[model samples]
Target chain A: MTEQPILEVKHLQHIYMKGTPLEHHALAGVSLKINKGECIAVIGHTGSGKSTLIQHVNGLMRPQAGDVVVDGMDLADPKIDIRLLRRKVGLVFQNPEDQIFEKIIGDDIAYGPFKMGLPIKEVRDRVKWAMELVGLSFEEMKDRATYALSGGQKRKVALAGVLALRPDILVLDEPTAGLDPRSRNELLERLKTLNKKENMTIIFVSHNMEEVAYMADRIYVLADGRNLVDGTPEEVFVEAEKLREHYIGTPDTVEILAQLKAKGFAVRQNAYQLEEAANEIIALL
Target chain B: MALPLIQVKNLSFEYAVNQTKIPVLHDISFEVKPGEYVVIIGHNGSGKSTLSKHLNGILTPVSGDVVVNGWNTKEWSSMREIRQKVGMVFQHPDNQIVATIVEDDVAFGLENLEIPPSEMKERIDFALASVGMNEFRNRPPHYLSGGQKQRVAIAGVLAMKPDCLVLDEATSMLDTHGRNEILKVVRKLNDEGMAIISVTHHMSEAAQASRVIVIEKGRIIMDGTPREIFQQEEELKRLHLDIPVASQMARKVQSHHHDFNGTLIHNDEIVKEVVRLSQREVPVI
Candidate 1:
């Protein structure tokens, strides 16, 4: 939507354990551009390089070949500070346990700000702000034992920890992977607020078609480390046949629409949400 | 002609902290038949995972008992026998995979059971093939995809020839494709007479099960076929659970077309109903 993209990846390629029997081409010529304040989703089957691509965005892994520029800063530049780059691009792993090590919720959230060498008062303020932003009440959860919290609560703590750094670009790998329906909904809502009110650039990696359909303004499909498709949710999801070939699935609404068309119903097979599909079916009826 | 593979009777479990008891599972009772595909659906803290642990003797119930293949879980002497009859696969595949090589990991459980080398070879071959991981048998567990690793984990469980498999959100951490891969294996195993008790939050996956059990606040709140369970979408939503997409779509269509009678648990049924409605001669107001 803008001349300068917030995130730009060009001809990215990565190989794991290169030049060995276990060599794996994790990413192959993957390219994408994310505009500022956009909610972008990277979807792929397992081993399709979704994780590999996101790691490059935050400098967690340097690009083997190709270029990745985040907010106008080329990640390949030798002079760029890795710490500053990571702070600007928040990366949340699939498992919250992997990132959250502090016993107390407040302590875990404050770890990022504290490490950034912020003043103690500012660190505390950011900790409370981050917790509240993720829907965790600071007063109630500050002293709560991290281990005692539910899976969703723990995930929120992990998100809060990253948010405490006030990263401009928030990237999450399967943020709702293990969450129940309610928690998933609550977290998505919170993210939507952040994307809208704060104009945060969100780039999430997920394989959940329904969640992608609901949340993503744009989607990039990866298969075996290669970029397969990229478009709006409706545009990408309508290619149910194409997605299936790569072991990727579209949202249930799109699948149902396809099924209806296959069943000789004169209905548009393009709906990505339940209400839209229902409207299309009702119109046809 | 055969008894249920798992019979949980008046099971109650609680965790103690600082002399205060916190109830986890409250008066839970259920039975899983041989070859039955049973999906346990619940929100976080609903005690679904705790109940799964009770089935395999990982945790003894505070009161009552779990009888697996007529062996009571409460009896300390029957722990090994119960564990043998009921194998468990956890959410994280990384945690479950032990050996470096795929075949070695599959053979880990067999070796623990003191199985002979000749028999172990046959069992491992059968197990790996059943889960469609034979191609990656020689590959390293660390190099395999998440889906492949989980299948290897399943193959490990299968090598022991457990009568039932308890997947404690095993597919929750996987992408959509990985989830389907594991579910396909589980369905195939169930069809071949391995009773399955899968604790999951994926409504679509739950809809494929022969039976669905809804857990809430440490109790078994609803138990029925997928159709019966999904029909009560409102009730499920109240409990922080969701109905499958097809069912949700059917509800939306029904709002306009009152006579749109349809069995809406699966995609095919919804398609058929949409076709029927399109062909109907009645003209709505």
Candidate 2:
């Protein structure tokens, strides 16, 4: 038997300020299915409904039409517990400052598990685990003032808070948007470890094609609140013309190969990794 | 030769926590000439944002000087003049936007200087036109896309008629399309003889800059052209930073075939070089 999807959305539709002059169709007939341990990326330009789609994953936004199911719980069911669903899917917003509240880092990260009524010892243990997972030392940084930390540290604290809940799935919206190259790479590596070692499903919304190419095993392209295409990074990026039509760009690796092909060089355009793209060009030479 | 537009000398900054002062920026010095496009890149908490704040008097140095157009930021009476000479745009567009309407938002800065209504109108028009947001002037900022909102923010700063623009991760919160929009405007402004100092972590953005400055642990560690800086790929990786993908790919190809000599940072340059190399009678390794 085929493995069941951990999260599934079918023909999802949403309209902002419905029936008013300022109403906007934010999502229209979008559909996607994600496996339990998969790392997926939803990429689109501004106003492309990527944010709206993720909001539905954790019950932040109910389906205006169509259906959403997370871990066998149907969102359309009136008796379904949103609180429980949120615990299963941790969603991190774009800005770390938006979610952080406690002055101390440890207390902030412990908030989620504490609210769940877990034992005090378990809460502390979970906070320690989450902090270490995000590369923050529990001993050194747990007492640090949240406001005094750098942008990267603040983001780590926010992520640790979400991870402390021990969610089955982690969703991040532009997780590396404002981070430096080092921090961005470190965060991506942590997420990969979560997916590989813990079997945690990862879903992220991003505008950075390079990040998407590096982290996503499966890719979904969105445009105008609709699912434009879905496939592996190489498959989606090879359709460069289609992505450009929607104001999306391919990763630099694929872009350079495509440019060489346009210049009459016999180079492969499907390479998404730097080493692979380099090999393709070297072969041509 | 044109006089320097801004100069920083022996700058040091510290943030006061409960009872202790924590230093965030070391003794730093740099000079930006007129019409120069300089990009400051570093890992998060490397004092890049802290340094950018000093340019416009947002943060006063503890033991150093920042002179803008011959006016010292340390002088209280010259603050207004210094601010008018150096306008800053921050990361988030929503936080920076004040007025409900786009045109009014652009005019807000002009009115602060108590400019006459006639001159205010002219300045607002010129500012909006410069960012290509004149058509959205009457619309609500909330209704605009992220890129459009950022353009509006830049217009607001432009209305002040600043000689230098300091962008502190201004494009960090924007999508790829939005980033491109902002870069296009910045490049055009620099072409028109306006000095720009952009602080960001995006190596691809740094590739477009005339000069690249790398900061680490609150100190300026490297300063040179993009080509000069990105060529030291090992050093950048050691600092937890990354060169642009195009540059990385070029180096990888160079490793396989020892003939590629030049340091190519941009996509087009790499693509052209690859095509030229493919035309040569070099054997693949």
Candidate 3:
């Protein structure tokens, strides 16, 4: 038997400011399925409904026409508990700084678990674990003023706050948007560890093709509030013309390989990773 | 040679946190020549943003000097003149956009300078056209995509007629399409004799620069042309930075093939090199 999906969206449709002159169709018949322990990436240009699709995952927004189911709980069911669904799926927005509120880092991270009314000890433990996972030292950084933290550290604190809830699925919108190369890499590594070691399901919306290629097990390309294509990075990136038509960018490695293939070098066009592309070219030589 | 457009001498900066002075920038010095495209890259907390802020006197240095267009930023009387000469675009497009309408936003800077209404109208028209936002001049900025909003932001800055444009991670929040849009506009401006100082984490963006500056731990560690800096791949990796994917692929091929000698920073260069070395009939794709 095929494994059941942890989260499923069927013909999801959403419209912003419906019934008004400024109404916009943000999502139109978008559908996707995510298995447990899978790392998925959603890529699209701005205004392509990528954000609207993820917002539906955690019951943040109810579908205007279709259905969303998370862990067998149908969001369309009026009896479904949204708080429970949110606890099972942590969502981090693009600018994590906007989510930070507490003056102290520890206080900010602990806010989530504390709000859940967990035992004091459990809250502390969760906060510590979350901080450690994000590479922030609980001992050294917990008491630091949130305002004083760098852009990267602030993002970590925001992430830790979400992780303190111990969500089985973590959904991020541009998790490394403003981070430097080092911080971006470190965050991707931590997310990978979460998926591999803890079997946590991961879903992220990003504009960075490199990050998507490196971290995603499956890639979904979105456009015009609908699913344009879905496949592995290699498969999706192979259709370079289609992606470029939708204003989607391929990874640099893939671009290099594609250019060489066009020039008739007999290089593999599917190699999206740097080392793999290099090796492909070297073999031809 | 043309005179330096901006000069930073012995630049040092610090922040006061709860009465404790925390240094964020060390003694740093650099000069930007007119019409140069300079990219400043660094890890988080490296004071790159702080340094950019000093360029326009957003943050006065604690123990150094920033002179732009022969006006010292330290002098209160030169603040207006210095700001008029150096325009800054920040990370968040939403944060920087002040007016509701695109054309009005572009006019904000001009009105502040008290330009004659006739000249202001002409400047606004030219600025919007320059960034390719002319069609949306009457549209509300909130409804635009991230890239479109950023173009509007650039248009707003361009209306001021600044000699130098300093972008503090301006494209970090944008998607690939949006980033390309901003880069294209900036490149054209540079070609037309405007100086650019872009602080970015995207190594691909750095590859297009005439010069690259690497900062680490609040200090300027490396300053040279893109080729000069990216050739030392190991050093960049050691500092938690990375070279462009094309450069990395070139190095990987060099390691195994040993004949790929030149430093290839761009994608086409790598493709051309691979085809040249393939020793096979090139097939047109």
Candidate 4:
């Protein structure tokens, strides 16, 4: 909607283990700009530098070449405060267990504000608010052991921990990876609220085609450490051959449409939903 | 003509958690014949992963019989042999891996058996190639994506020369592209007569398999070919599992059209079916 983007990654190149037998050029000259309040999904086959690229956004890793400019702050600048950056752009990793350190749910949620040197009252309020954000009840789960929570609940606690930090941009690496269906939907709904109500910029890394179709406003496909395609979900997924070549699978709806088209059927190639595709075909005949 | 690849009879497991023997699984029974690609579906806490673990002696049953290659699970001597017969790839490849180098990780399981070093390299090469990880044989695990790491995990097991491969939510953490890559590898392995038992929540993934088994609280609640299992649209939804988006569309269209006749699964199939239905003249009142 604007000329300047909320976040700009300019010619970002990342090389792990710079000069040794184990050296890896994980990313090579990747450049893209993400606007504020954007919900972008990053999809790629394993070892495609998706994780590497996202880590750079939060200053977790420094790019060997190029830089990530978030809110006009240069990621590669040595003088930049990584702690402040981490607070603004929260990154939740693949496993919930990795960051869940507190004994109880409430303490875990408050860990962020506590670390940020907030007053005790402020931390307490944030813990309650963050738990509510992820749909964890204060009366039921506040004192429960973090270890006792289900996989889905643990993921929520992790999310609550991030939310307490008041991040403007949330970068999640497989946030819904291990969740149940209800929990996944609930998390997505909460995330939609965060993106809309709180106006948090969301860059979610996922491989679930349906989730991507349902959630992402824009998508970036990666392969062999390169940005393969960048477009809206409808456009990026419509090119079946390109997706296949890049190891990205089309959404189930689109895949079905393509299969029908291949079998001497009259399904519109653009339909990315069963109902829409069915409607398109019905209208066609 | 030959022994079934794997069989489970009233298998149950309980572990002592805080002095209470919490039953993670109840009485569950299933069987996998050779060349069968079976997918077990369930929500979180439905015992899908626990069931997959029991298939390969990763977790021995406490109450029932698990027989692999005619070897009873209770027979202590069969533990190693059973594991050798049924290879496993876990949900998180990072935890499953035991080595740094890709080829070495592939060769890890074989090396565990004290296989002759001379032949180990060949098996490693073949296994790496099987999962398309051959080119990255010398790469470290940290440099790869979640899918590639999982593939290497699969190759490690492949090098062990197992006949049945049980993936316990293996693709749960993978993004769409990574999931597809793993699916292709699973299909390839199954086609080559490797009995595959994948425990997943993704119904779309189950659509690729020949048979789907839905487990609930440690019981085989639903079991049939993909077509048969998915046709039970209502039951799957009750279990909190999603029907393929195409099926949902079909159900929608079928409700309004009194004389619609089409058995469609993929969205494209819905498109084809709708096209056919639309072209039909209106029925006589």
lDDT of 4 by residue, B164-213 (tens): 89898898877776777799999999989898888887777788788999
Every candidate's fraction of true contacts kept comes to 0.86, 0.92, 0.88, 0.62
Query: CA shift at B260, candidate 1, in angstroms?
Result: 1.7
Candidate 1, A35-57: lDDT as tens digits: 88999999988778988899899
In model 2, how many backbone clashes occur? 0
User: Could you arrange the candidates by TM-score from highest to lowest?
Assistant: 2, 3, 1, 4
User: Which prediction has more favorable DockQ, 2 or 3?
Assistant: 2
Winner of 1 and 3 under DockQ: 3
Q: After superposition, how far is residue B196 of candidate 4 from its true place, in Å?
A: 1.9
- List runs of model 4 lying over 4 Å from the truth: A1-5, A18-27, A45-48, A62-67, A148-150, A222-229, A239-241, A260-268, B1-5, B99-104, B111-146, B256-263, B266-285
lDDT of 1 by residue, B11-124 (tens): 999998768798999888888888898999999889899888888999988899889888888788988788888999998888989999999999998888898999999999
Tens-place lDDT per residue, model 3, A63-149, is 779989899999988789889999999999988888999999999999989999999999999999999989898899999889988
Give the CA lDDT, 0 to 100, for residue B122 in model 4. 85
| Candidate 2 residue-wise lDDT, A1-285, digit = tens | 799899999999999999999799999899999999999999998889999999999998999899999999999887898899999999999886679999999999999999999999999999999999888999999998898988888888999999999999999998988888877888899899999999999999998998999999999999999999999998899899899988998898898888888877777788888888888888877
Which lDDT tens digits does candidate 2 get at residues B34-132? 889999998878899999999989898999999988988988899999988899999888999999999999999888889999999999999999999
Please identify which of the two predictions, 3 or 4, would achieve the higher TM-score against the true structure: 3
Residue pairs whose backbone atoms clash in candidate 2? none
Give the CAPRI class of candidate 3.
Answer: medium
Top candidate on DockQ is 2
List DockQ for all candidates: 0.74, 0.83, 0.80, 0.45
